[model samples]
Target: MKYYVGIDIGGMTIKGIVLDPEGKALCEDVAVTGSERGGDAMCDVIAELVNNMLSKCGVKKKDIAIGVGCPGVIDSKNGVLVFSGNLNLRDYPLAARLHERLDVPVSITNDANAAALGEAKFGAGKNYKNRILVTLGTGVGGGIIIDGKLFEGYKSAGAEIGHMVIERHGDVCTCGRRGCFEAYCSATALVRRTRRQMEDNPRSAMWTKYTSETANGKTAFDFYHDDIDAKEVVDWYIKYLACGLANLANIFRPEIIMLGGGVSEQGDNLTVPVQTYVDKELFGGTSYAPVKIVKASLGSKAGAYGAAALVMKD
Candidate 1:
């Protein structure tokens, strides 16, 4: 049976997985990114990890292909990492370097895009032909899948769903853009909004429950039912979130839009309301084409799983 190896490269850690063509993980492990050591050093570390996984599984190097899910502007067509501030990489030919060391074919993609592929193939969107994944973590990250294939835009740099502007001249995003969906929809955005509300309304129950340091994306949802201040914060967040989602739905009209990351842990609290608003504002009525909102099932492993999928057969 053919096997594949997947590497998920992050700022803090690099995760690796060995999987069968069937999408089941044979073995998986993780290691520190050691990003400060430069891209070459990082590739060496990943090669070592990949070798370890093969050794542990008694798999031969010649029998597997490698796929990488990296955080940055990945030129997947040429297997080069254009830029990744988190990894301090610039114009690095990651795939060629790994191929030199491992002697195997390698595929590369943006981490968010990999995660979206992972969910579409093996997680929440498995049943749908077209899907979009929106990860609301420290920042918003996502990808688009059409007919079960990842839709990376020109030069494999597109599918940056988070940067879509939902609010005109609204909050400033780390990307230096104003009113990006990420600026208002990310966990950082939620925490910032929650903290401001807590400070403004000293009598808010959230203050008793959490401090600025303690509050997180869940702060508003956690106290919304009982606290008017918290409720407003949550409502405000949902409004922007729905607007972004509605825009996506109107444009792509995918079968489902999956939500992942820290905030999605709210489950029904998040999906149920977001669905209501999205449906109400969707470009066309829900009768002709409907979209479903769901939570990603693969969690952190989605990137690795999706990376492995890079070489899998359809």
Candidate 2:
């Protein structure tokens, strides 16, 4: 029997999991990213986290390899992290260093790409050969899978779904662009839009439940049934989300588009509406080959599960 280790590195926490050959998690644990300590310190912390997970499961290091899902531009072929604003890393040879210290073959990928692979192999996308994962969190990020393989573009810098310009010259994006998909469809965008709507409709019931400070991605969603403003906000979000998704669907025509991250917790409320729009606008109509819009089953662990898959034998 063989085992593998997967680690998902975020700004605040580093999540690690040990998995058997069949993908069952034998043990899992987390550690503070300690990102303030710089890239070297962060890698050390990740190595320690892996060791802790291995110790907890009583697994021998010889039976395992490490797979890391990191946020940022990664040179997967060279096993180097080109840049990660949140992790404060640049041009770091993450895989090589980890292997040097832990003596385990290490693989690395962009977090979104890893999550997509995880879902495609073991989660909602397991049944499909081609799939795309659209995560609506603080920002929009996604990964593409084609013929059961992850597509990381040239130099592993592609698949940046969020930065796509859906509403050209519409709204300013954090990437310093106008009308990027992420600027209008992310959870952060949802909250910002909801807050503006709430302010515009001072007498609406939404004001009773949330203020600008209390408004979040779920605020309008929770009040959608009774508040016109709330419903409008959700509608606006769905419109942009569907536009971005439609672009991907037309280009890749994936069998399924899996939604993940915080906003996806809305489940059918989010998927149903977005699917309706996607169905309407997808190229060549839905009759020939319709894309199934579904929710990501792995949730927060998708990245970890995907990381582990990097070193697993299909």
Candidate 3:
């Protein structure tokens, strides 16, 4: 049977998956990227994991092609990673190198785009012609899939929604830009806001969840179910997030807006509140450009699944 391999590279973990031609999971493996150990070492770890997974599945190297879901500016056509601030990857021919080592065809894509394709082909966006998959993590990551295919525009850095400028003079982003959505709406943003709040009002109940001495180290989202301040921060955060979502919904008018990342796991608390805000602020009367808000069904594995799909077509 024909199979494809998918790899999702993150700051901490590197997950690899194998799927049949129909995209069914045959095997999955994970490795630590060893960020401190550097990129070349991390690639060796990935290769080991891939070889091990194929062996466990009783699949040959020639039976599968590889697709990598990496974090960075990927030139998908040329198989080069132009830049990756988090991973310290730059101008590397990742696909060609991996293909040479593994003795199989290999392709790579941005994690966000891979997740978008995963959703389009097998997850939430499967039934839609146009959809957006937004992931709120340390920073916001986005995947824009139009029609049934992943949109890789102008050298593959096309749909970077988090970097979209919402405010010209807002919060400064990691990319040195001011007012990018990721700077304002990411988990890092929530953490920053929590710290400022703690400094201003250190005796609040919110600080109780962080255990006085440790309050300075944790993020607002670290608040447990009983943490009131955490809820407040999230409420405010969701409101800010809605501003972006509303703007996108009004402009793109997609069938549905799919959210991923740790924040989306909050269930109705996040999605319901954000959707309510959108209902109130959006120009459409809720019927004309009605947008449904849903969480990504594939969760953390979406990127790997999507990358795997790239080779299954072989």
lDDT of 2 by residue, 1-314 (tens): 39989899988998899999788999998899998888778888988888888888899999998889999999998899999998888899999988877998999999999899888888999989999999999999989999878899889989999999998778999999999999999999999999999888898789887788999999998998998989999999999899999999999999999999999999999999899999999999999999999999999999999999988887
Write the residue-wise lDDT of candidate 1 on 4-106 in tens digits.
Answer: 8989999999999999767788999999999899888998999999999999998899999998999999999999999999999899999999999999999
Candidate 2 wrong stretches, greater than 4 Å: none
Task: Show where candidate 1 strays beyond 4 Å.
Answer: none
TM-score of each: 0.98, 0.97, 0.89
Ranking by TM-score: 1, 2, 3
For every model shown, the clashing-pair count is: 0, 0, 0
Winner on TM-score between 2 and 3 is 2
Best model per lDDT? 1
Residue lDDT tens for model 3, 142-198 = 787666667778878687788887778998998899999898788677767776766
Task: In model 1, state the lDDT of residue 243.
Answer: 95
